[model samples]
Target: MRLRNKPWAKELIDAHPELIQVQPEHVADQFAQKQPVRLEIGTGKGQFIFKMAQLHPEINFLALEMQHSALAVLLKAQVDAQLPNLQLVVANAENLQALFAGWHFSEIYLNFSDPWPKTRHEKRRLTYSSFLTQYQQLLVPDGVVQLKTDNRHFFEYSLISMNQFGMQFQQLSLDLHHDDTTWAAANVPTEYEDKFSAKGQPIYGVRAVFHQAKG
Candidate 1:
């Protein structure tokens, strides 16, 4: 799980000045911009976030990943693309509150996060109430959490948890590829998404808007 010695990671660390060691406490103040700020919790290989950043230059982006190798790949892409609106961080999703210092993000994207399918590992899933609580603390009023996955069980469990947490969800879809027209503007496929779809897997996705009334 540790990626400290990966060559790509080392190269990323050396290539990008914007990618610096960050603590959870410094996140909010660090990106207190007038423009909307969006975050991708697990930016794998940087394909999705990179394309998004390029497509929407006005919006600011923060990509968080604990895996050094993945972060490196993303950083390399950013460097190659010369994207100014993207920032990278190496951290766990659980530490979001500490990183943001009570700041609320405009939107949060959870793309194909680890399902942790076993019953005993349910708590570790990103959609758990505990993780939702942390996200609530850092999301602005009317903030949205967009999640996508190919796991049916995890997707169902996530819906239950979101309702339990009092979050409002809309634009739920069981088959994203079939409903591409509905989300075409904001739908950018991730590395996993492309692979799964290629092999004839159904992709599930949902959009949840955070509301404080439930909290």
Candidate 2:
């Protein structure tokens, strides 16, 4: 996860100011009337988020990553793309609640997130119930969380955790390659996704919708 030595990291740090920062209180009001905000928790190298920003100019995007170097790459990409609606946050995913207040984001993206395959590390998985609660706090009513991964075990574990949290799976695909219809529209292949898919890996993914509880 440490990318300090990467050449691209230094370049990103030098050009960081172009990226916007969203404090916890301002997140909701910033996108109140304009367009729904979409967040990507772990934007590796910036390929996916940049594409999303390019495709949807109206929607605001927040790319969060813990590694300073990786964040720099994303920031540089945003700068290069001249994307006005994109923001970058350098923080751990665990502190997402502390970074944004109230219901703000309409959609959340988790592309090729760390599997944390070991049993002891299950809690660290981004789709775990504990993380889902944090996401729920920031997500708007009926907000959706979209996730994709090549690890079947992690996908199954996520499905279980999502169900336990009472989130509904609006779309689910076991073998992304075999399902061309959905894949055609849904596939915006991230850097990791492209790498894995080219190697003939079977990608699995699910888009879960969060329905607010009635009082």
Best by lDDT: 1
Query: Which residue window of length 10 is worst by lDDT in model 1?
Result: 24-33
lDDT of 2 at 104: 78
RMSD to the true structure for each prediction, in A, is 2.8, 2.7
lDDT score for candidate 2 against the true structure: 0.79
lDDT of 1 by residue, 27-94 (tens): 44443355788889988777888888889888888888888787888887766776667778777777
The Cα local distance difference test for each model comes to 0.80, 0.79
Model 1 TM-score on a 0 to 1 scale? 0.89
Tens-digit lDDT string for candidate 2 (1-215): 45555676655655554464434344433332467789998887878888888888889888888777677777766667667677777667777787775547899999999999999998899998889999888888888899999999999999999998889988889877678666457578888888888999988989998767789
Off by over 4 Å in 1: 1-5, 24-34, 212-215
Please provide TM-scores, in order, for all candidate models, with all chains considered together. 0.89, 0.88
Cα deviation of 17, candidate 1, in Å:
3.0
The whole-model C-alpha lDDT of candidate 1 against the native structure comes to 0.80
